[model samples]
Target chain A: MPRFSSNHLETLLTAVDTGSFEAAARALSITPSAVSQRIRAMEALAGQVLLQRAAPIRPTTAGETVLRLARQVRLLDEEASRALDGSGAAVPSLPIAANADSLATWFLDALVEVRREADVVFDLHREDQARTAALLRDGTVLAAVTAERRPVQGCVAVPLGIDRYRAVASPAFVDRHLPGATSGRDVLARLDAVPLVDFDRDDDLQQGFLRRVVGHAPRSPRHFVPSSADFARAVELGLGWGLLPESQALEPLAAGRLVELAPGRVADVVLWWQHWNLRSTLLDAVTAAVRRVAAEHLRPSPV
Target chain B: MPRFSSNHLETLLTAVDTGSFEAAARALSITPSAVSQRIRAMEALAGQVLLQRAAPIRPTTAGETVLRLARQVRLLDEEASRALDGSGAAVPSLPIAANADSLATWFLDALVEVRREADVVFDLHREDQARTAALLRDGTVLAAVTAERRPVQGCVAVPLGIDRYRAVASPAFVDRHLPGATSGRDVLARLDAVPLVDFDRDDDLQQGFLRRVVGHAPRSPRHFVPSSADFARAVELGLGWGLLPESQALEPLAAGRLVELAPGRVADVVLWWQHWNLRSTLLDAVTAAVRRVAAEHLRPSPV
Candidate 1:
């Protein structure tokens, strides 16, 4: 087995992180030729090509194995440095993935609390709930808030709690787009014809709920507002009716600015916190903070 | 010369848009075999492969030529349909790319105004200011709000306005991380050592300004908060000092919730509106609305 030496692994990480050899060299304070040489030496030992050499570099299958090993080594190294220094400022930033809605609503509070006690830094990648685990697989992030219940290969999963959503529209939007309906079933049938707002193309929360409501996703026109805050605001501006998370939907509902389109109906996304199965004290601190804050904000997970 | 037929072109567009032959078939109400056959026939006529057999479909160089043609045809067809039917609802959604800050602040107002006049819909893509133009090149978005002053090929660029940003920190953040400075130079001198908050790794506004201030990007610890509204909120919550656009920073600055880190110094991003050079009335409406709203919010571009 060809072991990846730490110096060569550092070069590999910088190359992929920056996307090109020349750029990586600038970041690592080395020449592009040196970066190319280091990568070539590693490839020769491994007997396989590591990078695709594309504009934004991508790792080959063999490279992924080495990348994971490199990341593990890096984490252990950082943990060791923190232990030695004791000042805690030498800790490297921990990369994590989170869904946009959670990041917008409550995840930062956990990070802020963590920062208050530890001199730590973070690199957050905003990803879809369905896709965040891929970051963990690629060794791009150490932790994720994801919808996937099955733990990624070497990670442990914990239930964060349910993020409940309800179909809502501005009072003016309800007056304009949806027909008045008295019964719950009547509203369900009418949902197939009205305009809706989606967080993005992959945002099937509205569509999935409509499918459960009317047996198929609607052919209705949609306005894709890719940001979580903007998606709620789009509904408030009467662009279209949308599913707003309970945290965002509640206040406006009470204020009478937004009205529920479907009474007694809500969409619940059961979010999970998944992190590397590692034993660093700093990682444990983050995990604890995330659990504490999530408990405070979210409803209990269903059995 | 192989000219693409309208039906075959529609198949191409659907396949690329949906990202797989099976998904395209589902979307177009056809069988996957039929979708594959149509693309094969088109490829045979062109004497070249059009699509990359990736999990999510990708276009080859020759396919980009065809993709551009298909988009132009689709826009024209929708325009003709609206004219002949005399009903504005036949129009399809327009995909547009914008940076998070603009989308969170001023962009949606333009979209709401555009929605009021036409029954047209939108598909928004949230991208970094530096990369929005690439969305226009790939046919993923018909238009973009980008920092690129030069127009993409086949697109026209118009000045939106200059978005000015200032480095700000919550009062508590300053009290902890920064030295009380007597002069502008002293503040600049101390800024290199403090913790900072970034929108993401590629957010260079803070780094770029720091480089100009003291001649290089800082090695300070950073917290990456990806959302625009939340990035500003993270700064206000005393996470770290960050650059905030004038629109988001002013009220908090006046209210003493946030304090300016670098007084009288601001980073200005000159924004441009770029769209396909097509004469569609709907595209014209979006272009006009964007210009009108941007003028209302942003500072004038430098001469």
Candidate 2:
């Protein structure tokens, strides 16, 4: 097999990807003839016609093989540079803009595995679960464990499963707020009217729970705690009753730090994993780890 | 806004992504102290604690914003390089391994779009649809449009919808080959037993269609045509019956170039956009366009 030069491979890949020799030449700062010759050389080396020289040229089967390899070479070269530099991180840190509850509960653990094994890193961006995809579209993160299923532009969505949340509060908070509250909209309205801790302005967990329970959301003065742990702490300190991740609230509930505001009726937020569409090795490895963890932990979404 | 250097942003992004200053420093070819200093500098500049500085150094919200920007900058730079290079012909052609049917149909159009727009070129590698992931795992394609939902290790899957295929043959081929065919199984088995043209040794469209028509795939002598257009032409030249893309077959069949062997029973393959999970702006833009096209053309999965 003729060892195609890196320059040739890059050129051929670009030409085939770009479709026309002229366009490819322009992009590479070479003459169109240079692009043509390079492609010819590559095709000769591959022992097959790599591109169909149509209006916008397309790759032949043989061409696709080389193009894939070219991408790998670039990625590997980048990783190598980072490795050699010692000041540049080789492991691609996937910035995941996720909700606080997911972050505090299972998401962090998923990240831990990726970090330990994949030689990658993460920048976790906490956002309202409903709005995580906004971060994705804004190019804030490479991937997000989000609550949205509709993919952002230039991104793909995978069903990461659902997080079931129950309305919980400290015993003292519940006692002070709901004193022998009876059934029906009257009692539920009372729950809604009380002070509640929310993740942010966009958090629907508390309101969603209320709409389901009392036929309408709790019209309470809300405190946006933002951080999952901090939000939980606010509920524990009797700042207000709020929705909490079942996993995060377990220990605190057991120790009487919180109480189940609603026994049966709670809210379930379906979470999806949305990531930027890139052919990235490190990101891929991390995504796999996250998916594996999500499948194990989160509830299957109805949709 | 403080003009955070891409280098500084890169370092901070690496640390957050890697989960520790030490590991991030190692990846970036720098010392932990330098990583620490950079993070401190960023935090001091932003007037917010960007990193938690705990066991696994986690990025704070502000830190995540910077990290997201870093990814964007890097991706943009790569795309800019591809654009400037035109076809990337001056360098080694980037290999892009894809399935046979995609090469025959929508994939080429997508590549044409990339050519006209991004100005990069491609080296195409054609593999069996079921086996493209292996190529990716083996470091073949930088990006792939694969059938696998579970991503290959170090690769991410973007849903590109399905490629529906129909078992097709030339009218002359069918007339000579399947004389007095009644039962679908016998007809399919006989069809499979006859010599057929395939894209390659790994081409399963013929056998896979046979298996679907009958209960099992019939082993038969096959000629590998390799190229997408040639594969379609081989069937048109009365060589054998095989699965062809509906899009490619439409013209041929209408022109009496080929005939549908299995009329009602069309095999629909769910095609996904799988690429190296790299954070590249150009890749993202290309992926977006591809997905839009796939959605417009391909059938949505019934499940």
Give the number of the best model, judged by lDDT: 1
Task: Flag regions of model 2 displaced more than 4 Å.
Answer: A1-77, A80-91, A129-131, A182-189, B1-303
* Local accuracy of candidate 2 as per-residue lDDT tens digits, A169-212: 77766666678865433446578666666655445567677776
Compute each candidate's TM-score over C-alphas.
0.95, 0.37
**Root-mean-square deviation (CA) per prediction:** 2.1, 25.7
Angstrom error of the Cα, residue A135, model 1: value is 0.9
- Tell me candidate 1's TM-score on chain B: 0.95
**Could you give me the TM-score of model 1 versus the true structure?**
0.95
Residue pairs in collision within model 1: none
Residue B300 local lDDT, model 2: 73
Question: How would you encode candidate 1's per-residue C-alpha lDDT over B124-158 as one tens digit per residue?
Answer: 99999667876788787889998988999999999
